[model samples]
Target: MIPPALRIRGAVLVGPQEVRDELWVVDGRISFTAPTGTAARDVRTVSGWALPGLVDAHCHVGLDAGGAVDRPTAEEQITTDRAAGALLLRDAGSPADTRWVDDRDDLPRLVRAGRHIARPRRYLRNYAAEVEPDDLVAEVVTQAGRGDGWVKLVGDWIDRGVGDLAPCWPADAAKAAIDAAHAAGARVTAHCFAEDSLADLVEAGIDCIEHATGLTEDTIPLFAERGVAIVPTLVNIATFEGIARGAEEKFPAYARHMRALHARRYDTVRAAHDAGIPLYVGTDAGGSLPHGLVAAEVAELRRAGLPAQAALSAATWSARAWLGHPALTEGAPADLVVYPADPRADVGVLAAPDLIVLRGRPVAP
Candidate 1:
């Protein structure tokens, strides 16, 4: 049954600077004023510093290290994120068809990117639709139709011949595939961890980049000029040291490159941000990493030199707008997290949301 209206007092942070003393959630939507017909007794009260539901801008919902998991496992992943107050997830890519999640209101809302499209034998096994350049455009078109207005590509991977990370798609192929995706009304993003792929992907009209550890001074301006956004997924990048170590013996060049990227990840991210390149928080969870690290990701962004408010916005208000979701605006769905203290003062408060409201229902406290 639908819950009665909730009268939320204290600081209602609707935007970065926009705040109201109080607000109400009626009929599953945010309302600035109390409903005229509702009696005082019908209103439940909650008070704190409220922010819109967190957004995991580049996460994988139904995927794991090996590939797609069953429905139960997927449900567990979603619950983990929801408990962390990540109400909006941009599923960067997933092999599984998690469309069933939309029917489950208890789960966080998802913006799927269909599945990862990669060159044969280039990406993790079973995690992508491995194809040749000849088929890149067709594959992109297919994924675009299946996804919720987004398509993910494995723009770079380790080349066994070179024993180092290299661009996966040629410039022409990338341009064709990205154009095809745009034609189908979807934005294209790529998984890139090395510098080789940045220029091609950005030049091809890509919308975003995941794990953009490759962003360098030379390419930062291009991304800023094109208005391409990036989700650093710094939490996942933190694992690069281990990844490099694992490949040290077999692929020394790749290992060294990974180490270099890890060593300067912060500087790279900060440089991109300073150059006006958009940044967002993404844990890169569900593939080797555990779920529920949105707060940690936000903290990592701060460590990368984003100011407190900008870092918080990477996962809150600005992130929501980037993903095309509403924040605490009137008539929008009531998905928000409340903390005892203002998150802008210390983003660590996001790690322990005092209250979590989803679709106007007080789901967690």
Candidate 2:
């Protein structure tokens, strides 16, 4: 059955600030004008605060902690995210192919980064296209073709030989691979958790960094000058202490480093923001962390010293624009969420969405 035409009233559009009284959803598209002939009963009116649908910049759909999962499990993950009002998802990396989700109108819109490209045995098993430095360029080209418009790389990981976090790719290899991905019309982001790999990746013209816990005064300016964005994934960073405890006995140096990074997590983010480095909210969900924590990530950004509006925008307007997704714009897909109160006033209101509309149809929140 077709969904009723929606009349969203008494809500504020987070950005643009063009229409305050109402906006209409017709045939799964946003329209500012009233429908000419629709009967009153055929129209559904929803009232509350409205904003562009939430965006999860770093999430995995078809993978779990153990690695690639079956379709049913992936669908469940998507459902959990949808329930939490995340109508758009950027799949950071996934070993399993989830292209089938594109055909399902009920599923959240997804932009995938193919599978992660990592060095042999350097990344978690079964989660990356492990290739040696010599093959980095070729693998990036291949994954760039496989992905929507972005590619993921494991920039650094624990080097057991060194007993601490270390750069995964040599500078020359990273530069060449990133160039290859760009030639294929794809932007590249990397999973970076240490200070050493960041300068190399940024100097190579990387587009974004994930879990950038190792940022410092020296590297912050580099990232800012290059305009490289970072998704702090503070929600996932909350797990660092537990991980350090688990590795303390075996890798004391790595453990201590992780704890130190955790200790200054908020300060690191604040400094990055002050340096004008672009920040986006990402939960790093579908790894060890659970899905549907976009709200939590926004709250964490606030804790990191971003203003309330800036933190909310990290997950909403600003994030959508960064990913080239339109937000609450005319003729765009009608994907949005309604809140009981102003989320900018207190981001905690995000945890409880009054209604969620995906493709102009109201879905249960």
Candidate 3:
């Protein structure tokens, strides 16, 4: 059933600084002006502070710690995120085919990266397309074509033979693979956790980095200059200590490195933000972490020293723009969340949305 037209009252945040007193949702699109002939009684009135639906910049719907899940699990994952007000998700990498989701209006929109490209045995088992450096370019092209304008790479991981974290691909191979992805019209992002992989990947023209815990003074400037973005996934990084403890007996050096990274995780994120490198919020959910933690990820960004508004933007306005999606604009889909108070005042309000409008329908909180 088509929902009745909605009259949104109070302040609507069209962007960080842009706000309007009222907005209308007609048929499923936003309209600044009221409908021509609809009677006042026909439009449902919702009063609150409204903002664009949240975006989870990095999430995997059809995946879990063990790998691809069934369709029922994937549906559950999308439902969890929708309840959190994350109406758009960038599936950074997932082994399962979740294309069926795009057909469901009730589900959050997804931007999928076909799968993670990793060196054989270097990343988590069953989570990526394992390929050697000799096959890197070919795999990148394949994933790029399979993905929705983006590709994921496992740039660094523990080298059991070396007893520490190391770059998975040589600099030359990294450059060639990135070039191939670009040639295929896809932007490339890599999962990076240590310093060694930072420079080579950034220099290779990769579009973004996930879990960029290794950013430092030298590399910070390069990332800022190149306009390369990072999704720190600080919520996921919180588990580094536990992971280190689990692997300590087998890889002592790696454990120490993980501890060091965890110790300075906040400082690393703060430094990147200060250097003007673009930072987006990502919970790294669907891999050990539960879904619907977009609010938690935003709070984690605040804890990392980003100002309240900046932190909010990482998941809302700026994030939508970065992903080329619309937010509270005329003719755009009516996907928004309303709060009893201004979220700009305290993003914690995100955890308790008064109303969540997906497309044109009001979702129960």
The lDDT of model 2 is 0.91
Shift in Å, residue 25, candidate 1:
0.5
Alpha-carbon lDDT of model 3: 0.93
In order of appearance, the predictions have TM-scores of 0.98, 0.97, 0.98
lDDT of 3 by residue, 227-258 (tens): 99999999999999999999999999999999
The residue pairs that clash in candidate 2, if any, are: none
lDDT of 3 at 266: 95
lDDT of 2 by residue, 193-277 (tens): 9999999898898999999999999999999999999999999999999989999999999999999999999999999998999
Q: Candidate 3's error at 298, in angstroms?
A: 0.4
- The lDDT values for all models are 0.91, 0.91, 0.93
lDDT: worst 10-residue window of model 1:
33-42
Clashes of each: 0, 0, 0
Candidate 1 residue pairs that clash: none
Better of 2 and 3 by lDDT: 3
**Candidate 1 regions with alpha-carbon error over 4 angstroms:** none
Worst 10-residue lDDT window for candidate 3 reads: 34-43
Question: How does model 2 score by TM-score?
Answer: 0.97
